[model samples]
Target chain A: MSATTLTIQRVSPDAIARVIDDAPLEPFGLTDAHRRALAARLGAITTDHHRRLDSWLVERGGRVAARFAWSPLAARRLLGSGGFRRALRGRAASIRDGVRDEIEDLLARAASGRAHRGSLGDWLAHRHPAELALVQASAVEWARILAETGATVTGDWTVASADAYYDVERARTTLRARRDLLVLDGEVVVRVRAGGPTPSAGPGLRADLAAAAFAHPDGRAPRRYVGIWPDAGVILAVDGTLANVRAGTRDLVRATIALHRQGELRAA
Target chain B: MTPTTTPARSILEDLRGDRSERPPRDIETAAGLRATLDAELLAIRSVPARTSPLVISASDVTHHGDAVDITHATSGRLRGALIGQLIRLVAVGHEIIDPFDDALRAWRLDSPSPTLIAAYADLDANGRARLATDVAAHAASLRRALADVPSAWAVRTAVRARVPLAGGVVVLHDVVDLVVGSYCDASSSTVLLDVTTSPIGRSATSLLGFHAFVHCLRTSVVPLRVAIFSTATGELISRDVDETWLELAANDVLDVARRA
Candidate 1:
């Protein structure tokens, strides 16, 4: 781990394009040992109690509510889905039209009893037009920001969905991870943020990458993680190496302890 | 009272420059301007390390009109805040039903102010009626001036740009009311519009320049123009973003930083 080097670059949008395009393809071979090691580390933390940890919990420091609410997370879920890709591809007159069509489809699904209650579709159905307009506006801005990064839905690039890893011994303890987009069959992971870079961004991103590795079905870790902050016009690319993943695992453990302390305080 | 005669053109039409006239793309010039501002700001000792950074807004650079006692909410301030929300609704082409209610709902959506809500609750029947009348008049004026913004231009409301300088010690923040068009690398095409309830004042130009400056630094693409529309008097003022305006804005920021 000491011999491995972790590369992180903070650059402009255009330069980030080059960074993503010019990333070195490193060989990643993850065996059951690696998966077992990660699981063991997480399971050790949740041994005392059941815990569901995700990048948000590890990075932002909070408890995940039992129910979904209207927040940027919902927007992110839509942005990183195939439905949004289809919406973008539609020959709509305007971005708002595309978004409206997407919402209408969701409404139809909800009417047909396909969508779960308290989901984005269910929640949006009860919202006012003014609120929906705001959603449309968000979709438009996100689309524009993504386009500025020279990222397209075509080729090997596909929107990545959230992945979860449950503890073998503790079924209640799970680790969920998600990235905005991935390409080269999950070798490269991309996450888009709303604002500027922060002091905690690097560690947070590393933890995300680590969670992705733990939850990956093939037990393979990504080679790179690219974070794009459109509002701040900054991009961060971090290499995924064994040493870095170990460091990220440490971050996750610390965050889990902190969360447990908070929960204990609430109980007290 | 509403204007006796309708204007020949809407405020959006007046501010939306010719689509054929593409501003020249000078990435070098933009980069140089940003470098200059960064250097000037980096030299300032406005905020010390391990301390909360100083945030400079347009109001910090120039006089923000006559000061009112903020401890107590005034009808004028409430009207202004509502009008601002109404402009946001209009920018997104939301249907305006019951100007006062729509404005209040929009305002609460963006910022839920308990004090303002309490203030509104305290308003007597006559006072509430007068406030509603004023908001309706302002809504009419806004509608008359803004007309219908085409959805194709991708209008964004309350677009905020916060550019940190001097290693995050000093942050320049500004929010443009309405942004039209997209950022083009080949040429400048984005237009920023600021909606004000009051008549255009002397500091309007400075505010516009400050917005343009912060936007350029944030997006790295210089906007084509920055315009301000006054719903109070149906006045519109727009200026093409040039090196001069950006320099002036930088100086204004430096002045504020020096004072800090």
Candidate 2:
């Protein structure tokens, strides 16, 4: 079991571009135009999320919704497909006013179904209830997604709690062996550490949690790393802001650790 | 008689090469010129940010023959240095309302002989004297108009006399987007015309249409010269510019600015 955790970094447009370029879509005969359009669409959605999330944080005064709004995949599904064309085909004509109205109607319809579920308050409750500031339904969802990929995970993990008032701060404290709970299936495992931080009315709690996770221990460690695969070779590591962390950060940590291990082995 | 050599033909060429060797008299004078140049650059750069919201008709004549009327938007710091140089050249010594009537107009006009040059020379050095004083006043007016604002105003003055050319007409428009300065500022003038037409032939015959327009501005209307820097790229990318459309748009913008 590795002591350290995985760290998350802010995402950049260039990094996202590289990710898109490396993805499997390259083997197929997708045109540069198509690739560009997809990348642009993803970038736009990410930008919207960042902006809305920051504003939501400011307006709500540190109360974050659990689900982190819509998933990137869901955004792509809803907006990137031929849905716009299908919705507007028969209704709009050459008449400017008619076309505008039809377009508006189509957008309204599309926005109707998922609007309520995507609220910040509800998402936060789902992700982290009053019981624990760190664990949330979104984090669970991420763990499940990782598990389904057949990664090795150490389940029923736990950690030590302290006077820390935020998830980020509590993440820095070392977890006691007995109080922690670890759950593992396939590649992903969840470790719930007891007694650290509780949600407080004070400001900057989330940011603290985020910093401690990346810089401290107790979160995004070996379990999070090897949990990405069933075979469990390279250890992933990090601390804090598990869900809504920059996508693919776990893999980055795994790659970094793996390179370090290789160098060690060669030296030995 | 002052010993005179053929003055540089085009101020645009000198500026383009970073050879503005004719330095201002003092530090304050040079600083004034620099400040005005900077303001114009800012004005040009602001176009992209402002126009980013507005849906405009864009065309790339270099690649496509027709215009692509789409509701595309963009925001960035656009490059206007090249275009600004050309503009400053056109603005050097023209009168506030009648830039083309000044002795500086000789820079672009043909002077075949010494006799011809003397005939049109500044008889009393009035042209040289008027240039500095008039330009200073104009600069002051421009400064006042552009202060405390992200946008400026402009006016479209007609060009008088027929230019022997073809295809499209070259219109001379004013370049005042500031309101607080003198009534007329000597700025670069836009010679709007379709570049596809040859300098000779029937297409060039309408070159003189703007000459009368310039005359109108000198007398009744204030002739203004403005700088317009534009670059179009993407699926409809092109190095070629359609001066006719730009001229029309400039005219429209000028009217709007003056009225406001």
Candidate 3:
């Protein structure tokens, strides 16, 4: 009687933007005319803040079924942790305005030499209990949603601590292995929070993302990466395959870091 | 040699004003009793003014991350630190609405009162007839409860008597129980005694609050009696506590806080 786990994909900001742009704006089971009218209204503010408007939509038979707004605070908190460092550093471009300030604040604090000598996750935990609670709740929500989707999880999803350095990658992969569910091969949805790096599709961004992924708590090799600012309705999507979820999560995290680094370079 | 004149004066005065059932026990005449009280006071005073260990239950555990969770042992340590600090604050006679805030003041932990008094004043449904009277009564109660207890004199009296030092139990509708703890005589230096109980309004938070109070006594202050009562149910439970090791523990807590 294991619970179902969600095999989530960190969708690139660009791809996410496109999906939001192209999606028919209507509730789950709208008529053709109603969907068309709603689409027209949604198409107006669909460019920059598209990901903020982007939500989780479970599709069945070409129809949007269940939808939930990704928590911007939760996503940003994840980005601040060592677990999301790779995804954060992977971004080669810019993100939404709202998230940009928050990410910058965190980065600035880290750059100011206050970052923990150990892992970022430890730093976040010690410094931000209330905010981190939201991130934890979000992770739990992800597990709950996957369980609801009928994917039986074989093991629990967990983040390895700084003290448990050797088991980093194995930990993330375990989350996906829960209940013996197939790790989805297709695009995994990623909704960036407001306080993350901006989106850009550039070649150099990949290297920066790899570097950030290497620094993540999972500490795995990089693959495809994506960045988004869901709060601002923007997404930066890249395509790649990781050896496992740990590697993938790290690569995706790095992409965000790269974007922030770029922003720092421009400011300097 | 002077018994005929000076001692006769006391006998004559007693005969004229009052009657005695039996001769009073005099400390000067009773060498054993005098020696015992002296030893008890000295032992308490010698218990370096600070340090007490904190005990924690199992409820504080929670999951944190993958392969990470909060443990009861850690929580106990934290609770110890928190209570130790609170004792130090209350010892120095700091008046504060929040005990947590009270501990924040520097040098406030030097001499804290063993007994803490808190008051809640509620308006009665007097339709302008006895409004002033009710209001004055509430104010008087508040003044008495929060009155600055410069020392643990009243607490010592209660402890010596093994009774509620706050006078006869004043049970409240909202309060389920009340507990009182204090240091006593040679027999029970650190004793906890239950004072009163109500039949309703008991909760974990209340128990924890009293536990924290004992924690303060055990660590940075004195041998204490801890009484716990519920606001709703009024059931009371008490423990005569011996926290003589608090002095060493407070040093550890200080070191930890500095590092943290």
The candidate scoring highest on DockQ is 1
User: Which structure among the candidates has the greatest TM-score?
Assistant: 1
- Tens digits of per-residue lDDT for model 2 on B66-90? 3232211110100111112122222
Native-to-model Cα distance after best TM-score fit, residue B232 in candidate 2, in Å: 31
TM per model?
0.86, 0.16, 0.18
User: Candidate 3 on B162-198: residue-level lDDT in tens?
Assistant: 1010111110011111112221121222223222212
What is the C-alpha lDDT profile of model 1 across A1-268, one tens digit per residue? 4543444443333565566666667735456786676666656654456676666666575554566566433653473243346545665566555555676777788788888887877776766666655555556556555545534323366555455363534324666565777767778888777667777777777777777777777656678877876666566766667766776667877787777777778789
Candidate ranking under TM-score, highest first, comes to: 1, 3, 2
- Tens digits of per-residue lDDT for model 1 on B180-222? 7666455677789887777676777788889888887776677
lDDT of 3 at A162: 23
Interface RMSD of 1: 3.1
| Alpha carbon lDDT of each predicted model | 0.68, 0.24, 0.27
What is the per-candidate TM-score for chain B?
Answer: 0.87, 0.18, 0.23
lDDT of 3 at B174: 15
Models sorted by lDDT, best on top: 1, 3, 2
Where model 2 places Cα greater than 4 Å from the true spot, the runs are: A1-78, A81-268, B1-241
